[model samples]
Target: MNDTSRNVSFTDPWIYCLDHGYVTPMICQSTEVLCFLLGTPALVWCLWISLSGSISGGLKPTQIFPMNLCIVELLFCIEGLFQTIYYLFLPNNNMFLQVVYCLFFIAWVCRPLFQTCICVERYMAVVQPVAFIKYRLRRYRMGTSTLIWGLAIIYPCFTVSSLGYLTKTNDVLVSVYCLGGVVISFCCFFILRALKQPGPGEVEGGRGGEKKQRTTDPQKMRAFSIVLTNLVIILVSSILVAVGFFTMPNSGIDFYCNTFLMLLACNMLSVVVSPVLHLHREGRLHCRKGPVTN
Candidate 1:
């Protein structure tokens, strides 16, 4: 067995592990194929939407986040697609395992960090509307996007400091980091909910559809919903990381492979899911003439 992969990882060709769950070579190969299939359509859909989304005037500012997310996910899908190919045909290339892990680590970390950034921006829009509007979103979005990517790019440098070595501990730390981000997102979600409390002008219509107005603050409400969707995505992705961490292939050989396989496959999932969720939530609101929606 290779030094980079231990008992319950891809290198393990057997079935069942007490710790990581059931995952033989066959299971691993099948999971990779499944991810490739799901990621393909998601990649195409995200690309088309991102490209078209920019044309809508109201989507100019807001589209940046989803577009970026979709693009990143597309890269993720490509990575997984190549991985499936590698596993299926390049069985002799065992030396590249660490490289794959490095790429996956970077992509996994990026997913949550971007979502966190989205939440923070939405928070500003909701908590401080005047400042958000007056300050202009384009310049700040550019800066924020650069900063987040800068941080994400450099993150792998420290984690894989040895350059040639990859460790199981790296995965655990990434999961922990993701869990922390999830907690922060949860706090953001709560703050959004608090702001959504019924206040003056919040009530809409009566039983007979009287001329009662709707919404306490439409902008704030919209921001709230956007953040909520992001929060849900963050939570699910983070939970998967947590499970992978706990079920790491440290002990049992056969039982643990499933968790490891799931972890690897899901590294491609957030990219697909995040874009789809964003579109489902805000697709209709991106009017071409209105202020750049976010």
Candidate 2:
């Protein structure tokens, strides 16, 4: 048998335990398992909605952006499920395992970048309707989507291979955090700016000689409000993760629990809540009565 003694050490109790043939903590295992279970259902639902052409009103070009976002989230969550299972069941896979874990981390990190793009697209639709419509032509949308994905993947790859670092401490435990806080912060700032912009196609018009002012539609305003709420959730979650890393002492139960749960919550929240909110806003939840028109 492989020598498990080398895995355990005094500094990192968790790794020591794993190395000494003890199971990972019940709470950690349970949380990971639950994340996997929840993520699976959420991913399946997203895929079903994306493919059914019912989620965003028959695959309109505008809807394609969010649908692509859904696909990325689904793929990331599915990869997360596999990583959780592998960690729980096969903890000692060494370098190959580390590479797999890093791949999963890349997916996790790329999610927010894609989300920021989605927010930008929505902002354009509302604040620059003319430009948005022009860009919705097939060639432009396809080319833009391709560019976004390429940049998202390539940037992270460069960071991970360059300045990004992942390592075990003297404590011997492994943590898979990365250093893209600046990117995340920049994304949040832009998304917030987009959210604050006025709705699309506002023009001034008035009775008699006076021009009537163009204004945002109340329904569209409500949709923006929903998007704003989701953005706040994401921003707050990202902030908490950053704070936890910087302020909390390393290798503590509270630290690990908070950081892991925060990230897991952030990912799951976008996957599970976004579609529901969109459905609600579009009145699709009442489809049994009749199909909701967007």
Candidate 3:
């Protein structure tokens, strides 16, 4: 009877949550395995590609942002992957629980700071080209990056092992809003870059002195595609974070959705390195006329 009761409590939704504060139902175990197994390899490959490019070309302003993102994602993945393992195998020791919270909190908070850095950098480059050039001239890009890193390192200090850090409804609401805002900004920036008018020199007559519509450079198009892809992936993860952070309904669908989101959030930043890998594979950034002009 004791073994049977123990087994029941192990898989039971109500007692299970009470016993293991961060864990979910046994039904969610498969989702955890799937996300960990599939996501980790892709992220590892993504990191390798990003790291290789950084070593070969040195870090450009754009590359710096993504590279930092890649590193943050890797840390998150390592911590998450371990948490899943611990939940399955080890008994919930208080010390281990504190450690898990510490790592997860660090990844949770720092990941966004790096992601915001990427968006702001890309927005400047793709939308406000003139300002981007000025920022580069004044070394503002480096300064901004330095500031971001400092904050990433510091933000986790206050939150390590604190349940309220990520769980507070107010914080979750703010993060969801900020994340959604950045996603929209990135989309707008890409559209503006793609639809930008031709340079003054490129304006030419076709048959009867009409200005011809110019196509965007293939290289630039590819770069834009890659960044957009990254933004979309990260935005999806952010939504997941919001759902998991906030109190949602206890229905079956809601449970599954939040679990899946939690799993995906572990390594979604892998998308950050995909663009860099694609650039390396294509031998240059996809757009023909590069946007990172002086």
Cα lDDT of candidate 2 equals 0.53
Looking at model 1, residue 44 earns an lDDT score of: 70
Deviation of model 2 at 53, angstroms: 2.5
lDDT, candidate 1, at 74: 59
Alpha-carbon shift of residue 241 in model 3 (angstroms): 2.4
Candidate 3 lDDT tens digits, 1-294: 332223111123333453555344444444445545655665666667767877898756666666666676666666766666667665456566556655666566667766776677667766778988877543555676677567655655565545645334336444744675566566556655654546555566688878776656655565666666666666666666665444332234334333634444443434344544544454555445233422
Q: Which ten residues in a row have the lowest lDDT in candidate 1?
A: 12-21
TM-score of 2: 0.62
* Poorly placed runs, candidate 2 (over 4 Å): 1-32, 54-59, 151-164, 167-218, 244-254, 257-270, 279-293
- Candidate number achieving the greatest TM-score relative to the actual structure: 1
Angstrom error of the Cα, residue 89, model 2: value is: 1.2
Ranking by lDDT: 1, 3, 2
Each prediction's whole-model lDDT (CA): 0.59, 0.53, 0.56
Per-prediction TM-score: 0.68, 0.62, 0.66
Residue 258 C-alpha lDDT in model 3: 37
lDDT of 3: 0.56
As a whole number from 0 to 100, the lDDT of residue 267 in candidate 3 is 36
Q: Of the candidates shown, which would achieve the greatest lDDT relative to the real structure?
A: 1
